[model samples]
Target: MNIAVVTDSTASLPHELRTEHGIVVVPLHLVVDGQEQVEGDDVGTDWVVDALRRKVDISTSRPAPVSFLRAYEQAAKGGADAIISVHLSAAMSGTADSARSAALESPVPVHVVDSRTIGMAVGFAAVSASRDAAAGRDVDDVLERLERRLDASSVRLLVHSLERLRRGGRIGGAAALLGSALAVKPVLHVQDGQVEPLERVRTASKAIARLQALTVENHDNLPEWAGGVDIAVQHVDAGERAQGLARTLADALSTKVETTRLSATVASHVGLGTIGVAMVPRIAD
Candidate 1:
């Protein structure tokens, strides 16, 4: 059976990977100072960082159902027997809902999976699905592999401030931390598809250190089925710091680490100087 894999820009999958795997990407929308632009296309992390630095109004919107319908139609036209659409967390964005709406009108069987996470965690899931589909695995097998990757993944972020997240309404339980004393750095994580506060520190240095320690701890605690772990360091306007963090992680974990810029949609919420790490277990082939 020929299956097609689809994902959103917020997945943070590199262009090469997406192209190599034939994964179709649906971009979300970024509203910049009242002007709307497509994420990853018309706007990217550089634009978002500049806008944030200038205090420009920035917000994100999910793609319309028609956008996803078009993607499904094109895939179907390319002779796909089925499609698996993986997307970012529903708690953070309505992209999944739009995909579902399009699936109802699709010509082929479209299975929309809410990754319940963002960044490389979702990217890894899409890659896994694409690989399984290319291997001629059944739809169920492909979905199973995708779910396994999601279940074995953990993401942590260190942001200079929580104001951006609060302003975007993406802060879940982390809202309480905003009331604390000033100059407090926050470390957040994705839990139950919502961004929640994990730790609060007085300095960015301390927060970065804590972020690394927590990642190491999480890596050590993974289940045996994980086989191995893949780590990706993500940042918004903090490339140097992200590279440093990735190098430290690579040395400590004895594995290669990939550093990628967060998509504009996510950066709009996280704001500048945001650094994150996403770790997913590599399931045995």
Candidate 2:
């Protein structure tokens, strides 16, 4: 049976990679205040970011069931007997739920997976699966690779501003105030499947240094630390800096780097200058 893979725009995959592989990408809506703006439709990343800069309501909406249904239908026509719908973490958003519901109504059998991470973390899983499928692997193999990567992965995000986060209800107004006062650069971590604060520094340079230090410490401790594993370096409105970050990380880890720009959708939440580094942990039982 021919197998197909599907995912949402929140994955923040690069345009080149998405185009190379025929994976179907569904977009989730962005809610500007109470009004709903469909992903890639009524509102885009620029619109959301501008609104946030102006202190406008910056709410995001979950993908509707109909979106998944459409992708499933197209996959079915392309001779897909089975489909794997991968999405952002359920803890962060209800995108996975929409995929599950759409799967139930799909013409082809569907297996929905919650990547449990946003941006390139989710993108990595989908890319891995699509590559496996392209090589004539079965659906089970694709799913296994995805799950394994997630199980052995680490994510670190350096958010430059807390105002957007405060407005989004991620950080309390009080905490945001304290964070700003202390120059506390909160080091957000992705553990198990949720985004949480891991540490806080007093400067932007320190935060970037902290990220590099962690990569060196964790990766060096790995049993199979062959120079470096795949590092997906990303940032919002920092594509130019993305290259420099990648180069610096490569020098520190002595490994190759794959850098990409965050889609406007993810930037709406991470906000501007949010630098994140994600890597699959050293293989462990």
Candidate 3:
């Protein structure tokens, strides 16, 4: 059976990686100053990042059903007998729900899984699903393994500022209050797909160190994604810092990590200078 991979845009995957992997990305919407823009339509990460850098007002919305429907139809037309869709945590966004809704009427079977994490944590599972499906694994078996690996993955975020989060009311006023009084850096983690305040530090350096420590501890001194046992660093316009932190994780985990900046949709909420680490485990599909 031929299977295709589907994921929402919140994963922040690069253009070349998406193309090379033959993965279909369903984009979410972005609203800036009350203007509606669909992901990959009115704007992409680059344009959204530019708007964010200029301090334009911004917000996010669920992807229109049409986009998901269109993507699903395309995958079926491209000889996909079934689709294995891995997506960002349902807690953070309605994208997964949107995908599921549109998939009900698909010509081919679509199995949607809420990856329960974002960035490379989810990306790892998505790509792995793609690989396993291409290798002719049963859809149920592939989905089961992806679920297991996703459960074993861990995500860490070092947010430079909490103003955006506070303004959006995603967090309590405590973060904003502390920021106003004195700068406080917090290490954020995904606890059951919800952003939970893991630890609060005073500097970015300390936060990076903390994340590195977590990766080493959880990974047992090595990554488990079957993708070469590695860690990945994603930042928002924080390439230099991201590189430094990636080097730290690399040494601690004894593996190399990709050093790439995050998408604007992610950066807009986390704000610039945010650094994230994704640690995933291995399981046969």
* Backbone collisions counted per model: 0, 1, 2
lDDT of 3 at 245: 81
In model 2, which runs have C-alpha deviations exceeding 4 angstroms? 33-36, 41-44, 170-182, 222-228, 281-285
Model 1 ranges with Cα > 4 A deviation? none
Q: Which ten residues in a row have the lowest lDDT in candidate 2?
A: 170-179
Relative to the true structure, how large is the alpha-carbon lDDT of every model?
0.90, 0.76, 0.77
List the lowest-lDDT window of 10 residues for candidate 1.
Answer: 176-185
Rank candidates, TM-score, best first: 1, 3, 2
lDDT of 1 by residue, 18-82 (tens): 99999999999989899989987557888888899999899889999999999999999999999
In angstroms, the error of model 1 at 280 is 1.0
Q: Deviation in angstroms for 194 in model 1?
A: 0.3
Q: Estimate each model's TM-score.
A: 0.97, 0.88, 0.90
Model 3, 1-285: lDDT tens per residue?
888999987777777778878999887778887887777734766676677788989998778767788888999999999998888888778888888988888889989899878877777777878878877798997888788778778888888777776665555323534444245678888878777687878787888888878877777744344544535788877788889888877776667687765665666777777889887766622
Evaluated against the true structure, the overall lDDT of model 3 is 0.77
Candidate number that wins on lDDT, 1 or 2 = 1
Best by TM-score: 1
